[model samples]
Target: MEHRRLGDSGLAVSEIAYGNWLTHADGAACVAAALDAGVTTFHTAAAWAEGAAEEALGAALAGARRDDLVLCTGVFWPEGAGPNAAGLSRKHLRASLHGSLRRLGTDHVDVYQLLRFDYRTPLDETFLALSDLVRQGKVLYVGTAEWTADQLAQASAAARRFDVPLIANQPHYSMLWRVAEAQVMPVCAREGIGQFASVALAQGVLTGKYRPGHVPPGSRAAAGGEARRSVWPLLMPDLLDRVGLLRGVADDAGLTMAQLALAWALQHDTVASVITGASTPAQVVENAKASGISLDLDVLTRIDQLLGSFVQTDPRLTWSPPATG
Candidate 1:
């Protein structure tokens, strides 16, 4: 596994990070496979599986060397019914960091991120809280997910003022979904913010498992989960047809469709890591191989030709604070 510095930070992360967003149930096996495959970065979130994901990961990494790994988790999603149980307020931030630490069975996370920007919270309060966590030795660095470019600028300024280690950004990026390419990528590059590319496989759409006219058995969409449901609209027949066209490109390179897609995401200079998840040890091994593959200009042009006009590159698709009831 190739390691890269996360933005301008001193911390080094594997190019391919093992994530457990949807496969929290296969935590131990998947984590072991990743570690065996030379993967040193592991990402999870407190909101995943209502915290079961962290527990499972903690158990899986119990015997690993703490200083040698980059373990990341995040806040900003509800952990309970209380009004203050979520968001980026100081109270919630403090509480969430502690909770994440307890679940991960670690003193501190390598990078503690805000899962989403909270428009309702004051930037001062949020930065101050994050700084405090650094001072308290609960979090080494702070990051954001799905934050707009303007928000990143403000946060970057606040982090500097507060001396908080704001080192990375997590956003959805894939061949099929280019929402982060427009504004977010440029701002992050300018700010020296490393990007942890999420949904790099476009919710498995880039895996080429979903046929144009038939839903494969035991696939993510066929499994019928909330994550799959959220991205179902992108699984149209036309989209699949375009995806099939890319298979020829992958075949020419002697790579699987998944590896080709992952390599494309890693091709971006601003991308520090491409986050991938798997439900089995075999899948974990397969995904890790993408880190070794690199795409050239000709292959990229071929991909663009095959997927022309079908890619979703709208920057307006960025996430926002959920409306209160």
Candidate 2:
């Protein structure tokens, strides 16, 4: 697998990293499959499946060299109902990191990220906490996720002010989602922060699996719980149409829709890694193939048109870009 630098931190990660939150303990096969398929990088969040995901990933990667791959995880979510259970406050950050390390079975995570912007907690507090982790060697690098330009600027400034390193930021960016282009991407570029783009497949919408009135049996839409049309409205007519268009482009390229979607996201220079969610070993194998393909600009242009006036925030985080500057 080809690797890209995570900003200026000198850490290189595979273009398409494996994600294991959705799979449980019984799904170690999926974990093994990812590592076998050259997915050296693994991306997960502290709150995913209440840490089960990290536990499973940790057990699966036990024998691998810790430094050979980049392990990224994030903080700032309700891990418990207590007041300190969530947010980027110093207390929660520390507790979360400790819990995460224990779950991941590692003393430290290579890249420790503030998963989201906390309106309540001051950015300084978050930066200080992350810096302390870095200084203490419980974390190698610090990054942000889903933060606005103003929030990111404040964090970066605080990092510099406190003499700490903030190396990366994870955002949603794909052929279907481009709002980061106008805001977050530039911030990272100016600050030399690497971007780990998530939702690159728009929660399987870009996989070309969901169509008008037709949802695959085991697909996310068909899961039919909180994840069905109620959560993401996969039945949206426009989304379905875009899927049809993308499927055609994938066919012409002789690539699966999922592969084309992931490849297109990886084509961006600013994107250090594209995080993928897999429920099956086959899915992991298929997603790994995306790491090796590069999409042509002409095809991307056609994709832009089908996506219509882009959306910055979709229900499932599959944002679209605007039509004009």
Candidate 3:
């Protein structure tokens, strides 16, 4: 797998990162399989499964040389009682990082990201707390997940003011979710920060698996009781037709929709990495295959037209335009 310096930071991470936001219950083998396949970067959050994910990841990576892989972890979600247990306060960050360290079986983490913006806390305090982590040697670099363009700019300013390196961002960017394109992407490009695009497959919908009468047994739609089916709910005929058109594009390229989906995002020079959450090893390998493939202009233009077949005012997405064509 190809590796890149995360954002402008000196640290390097695999283009595809193994994420375990679900099903850490039996993840050691899965994580090991991913590591064996050259997926050396792992991303997890403190809120996933109420601390169980970090514990599971810790057990999974135990004894592996630290330099062999990069462990990316996060904080900023409510884990328990009391106000101090959540948000970007120094107290919670300290508590969470210590907890994460113990769970990941490491003295320090390669990257410690805030899961999202904490409006309750002042940007100054949150930025400083993260800065302090870097200064104290507990966190190699500080990053934010799902942060807006404004937040990124403010945080960048804070990093400059404090001399802390805000190196990366984690955001939802897929054929199904493209809000980042409207702002976040440009900010990262201008700021010299890495954009780690997560859910690049859009919960497997962009894989072209769900059909008019079929819901693949192993898909995330069936992983649990997912309410949001594909962006085009199977019940909607027009959207299903659009999906078929998208699949034809993938077929012509000899790539699965999933691969094309990831490739489209990786096409961005600003994207530092794409973190894919997989419940199985096969998925890990499939995601890794998308790393270096670049979609041609004609296909990308068709993808836009295909997606443009539907429009909604929800503002949850920004239907991807042909980045190449």
By TM-score, who's the top model here?
1
Weakest 10 consecutive residues, lDDT, candidate 1?
316-325
Candidate 3 lowest-lDDT run of ten:
316-325
**Over 4 Å off in model 1, which ranges?**
23-25, 323-325
Best candidate, lDDT: 1
TM-score of 2: 0.91
For model 2, how does the per-residue alpha-carbon lDDT over 1-325 read when each residue is reduced to its tens digit? 7788888778888888887656554468876887788878888878888888788788888888887877888887688878678888899889989998998889889888887778777778878877788899998888888777777788889999876779888887777667677777778889989888888888788887777878788777777665575326546877788678777888998889999989888877789889987877898888888886877878988877777774444423422221110
TM-score of each: 0.97, 0.91, 0.90
- Model 2 misplaced stretches (Cα beyond 4 Å): 229-231, 310-325
By the lDDT metric, which is better: model 2 or model 3? 2
| Candidate 1 structure quality by residue, lDDT tens digits, 186-287 | 998888899999998888888888887777776777766686686688788898899988889999998999999999999999999999999889888988
- What ranking of all candidate models by lDDT puts the best one first? 1, 2, 3
Compared to the true structure, candidate 3 yields what TM-score? 0.90
Shift in Å, residue 275, candidate 3: 1.1
lDDT of all the models against the reference? 0.88, 0.80, 0.78
